[model samples]
Target: MIRKRTLRHFIVFVSVSGPICIVLFHQTSTRSFLKDSCMCNCAMDSEGRSWFSQRYKPSANVTLNRKNGLLDFHTYWWWKSLQNESVVANYTQVVEVMFSLFPDKDHYTDSSPSRCRTCAVVGNSGNLVGSRYGALIDSQDFVIRMNEGPTKGFERDVGSKTTHRVIYPESAVDMGVTTHLVLLPFKILDLQWLISIFTTKHIDLTYMYVKPSIIADRNMVMILHPAFIKYVYDSWLQGHGEYPSTGFISVIFALHVCDEVSVFGFGPTKDGVWDHYFEDFKSDPNEGPHDGDFEGKVISQLHQKHRIMLYKGW
Candidate 1:
């Protein structure tokens, strides 16, 4: 009976002293751990916790300066000549308006002080076939994929390094989302797509809805607010070189949202190939309405600026 009583007392003592020992081990002579721990001033946050902090409350102070004079020529010209109608009335205009909003900086450096981990915006052409860049591309910090496409034999060409998928309600597909999903749309219909298509299973959805919008469903998906979008847009508009290429949009999405970014399938092919990926391959190319040469020139300039990388060779 006496030994049982002693054992119970010993158990109680150890439980109370275990925490006290830990507190002493981590505590400094001048500062008391008790006071600091209450305010989250304990030892460094674990790796997992640090990652969460970067995702939720990043230290970098991102601000969007979009005053009147700050607007660029295309932007000033477009907005000043604006009718009372919607600013982004068409797809072309939407692209234009989106390009106008860029981030303050482009490159995100890791250990290299000067060169950042540049993103190669590879446009889906048949050029990337047999390039053996699927695993290499996947090694990048972040990869962005867009539109509807298949990735079996053409994995090298399309790159399997898709860290994020930018989707609109209209183009939402059943392709599996392994990492993050970003919805780029303005109207309620797009939001509906975000809900119906991206179905909130285990995926994390972020809505970069621009102004003149609202969150229809409270529990649908986490939104990034128009202010953040405007911030990115303004930054891109003021950015150097060809302001807002398709790759530029991806970079802007990453600069504002992700820590580092790498692009794939975003440049002109060896020749001219624009048929949908699912469609059979072809030789003749479809240069967009804008002259291919002109667009290529702009893309080259963005590459030089390090804002984007053009995947030219195999």
Candidate 2:
């Protein structure tokens, strides 16, 4: 009896410790890998220039003038007060470089002309299943969709009228008729992937990475500077949050790209409902890993606070 008890305890200990040990080892390995993998934490500005140090020293808070290649100021004042643990300086720089690479319409206040007045951002969440927002969606002058946005499933809830599909090369859908394909990438790797999806002959179908690109082609690719992403990260996301999901990014893109916009199939309703039109309408009380209920609550709050019209109707 004594031997059996001792053996049972040992078995239980090994079972628990085995997985825990593996997890800790994997995490430590990843940390070490991240430390060594790339010297430049993020892509450089459009100029493809960057300053980075392997040591976790404070980054100098500075502003750069892209056109004339000038620096306004340099200091560590902005980040000195904050806890470095909560700061992902590398991630922040990555976003900043992405913004610098893109054009800023607000910066060109004198030249920034309004191209979109009425716009609609459509998501493929299950909420759009039965609600017939088709005609209402079609009435909008501009419509933007993100990854895997299907028009067939909730054909009634989210209309078939897609003016533009903003996607990485992997997510580009077949836009048969007048719909346009907007490519968003300055990196050669990203462009290589895009070329594979869109045939080389159709390369002209691509758009510019800036406002001048927009003017050059009224149907130019709309690229938001990574700085705007930094703004959203710092302000709306509270700093440590995950990058905005594709759907949320689409909304922000529309906000800057248009004046009047209505959001469709965004968040979950009051009843803890989380179903996408494409998925079965039956609600599984058991929340899954990808549960949207928590996100739904935040989206609801943002809608109320921002006065953005959210379609919660059936």
Residue 148, candidate 1: how far off, in angstroms? 1.5
TM-score of each: 0.46, 0.51
Q: Tens digits of per-residue lDDT for model 1 on 1-314?
A: 99999999999999999999888766643233222111112232355333323333222223222222143455444433322323223433333333243322222223221223333334555456555667766666666665454566666556665545555444444444353344554342343334333243321332433223222322222222233333334443433332233334455555444323344554434565543444665532223222334445544554454334445545
Candidate 1, position 65, lDDT: 20
Positional deviation of 68 in candidate 2, in angstroms? 11
Clashing pairs in 2: 98-226, 99-225, 99-226, 99-227, 125-276, 126-275, 126-276, 126-277
TM-score of model number 1: 0.46
Q: Which tens-of-lDDT digit does each residue in 1-314 have in candidate 2?
A: 99999999999999999999999887655543432221112222322121112211222111122332221222122322222233223433433443344432232222122122577888766667667898899898888777567887566778888887766544555555466455533232333333333333242232323111111222333443333434433444444333434565566555444545688877653355756566655554224322244345445644554324578755
Q: How far is candidate 2 from the true structure (C-alpha RMSD, Å)?
A: 22.7
Q: What is the lDDT, from 0 to 100, of the residue 79 in candidate 2?
A: 24
Question: lDDT of model 2 at residue 298?
Answer: 44
Steric collisions counted per model: 22, 8
Error of 2 at 220 (Å): 4.7
Model 1, global lDDT: 0.42
| Worst 10-residue lDDT window, candidate 1 | 33-42
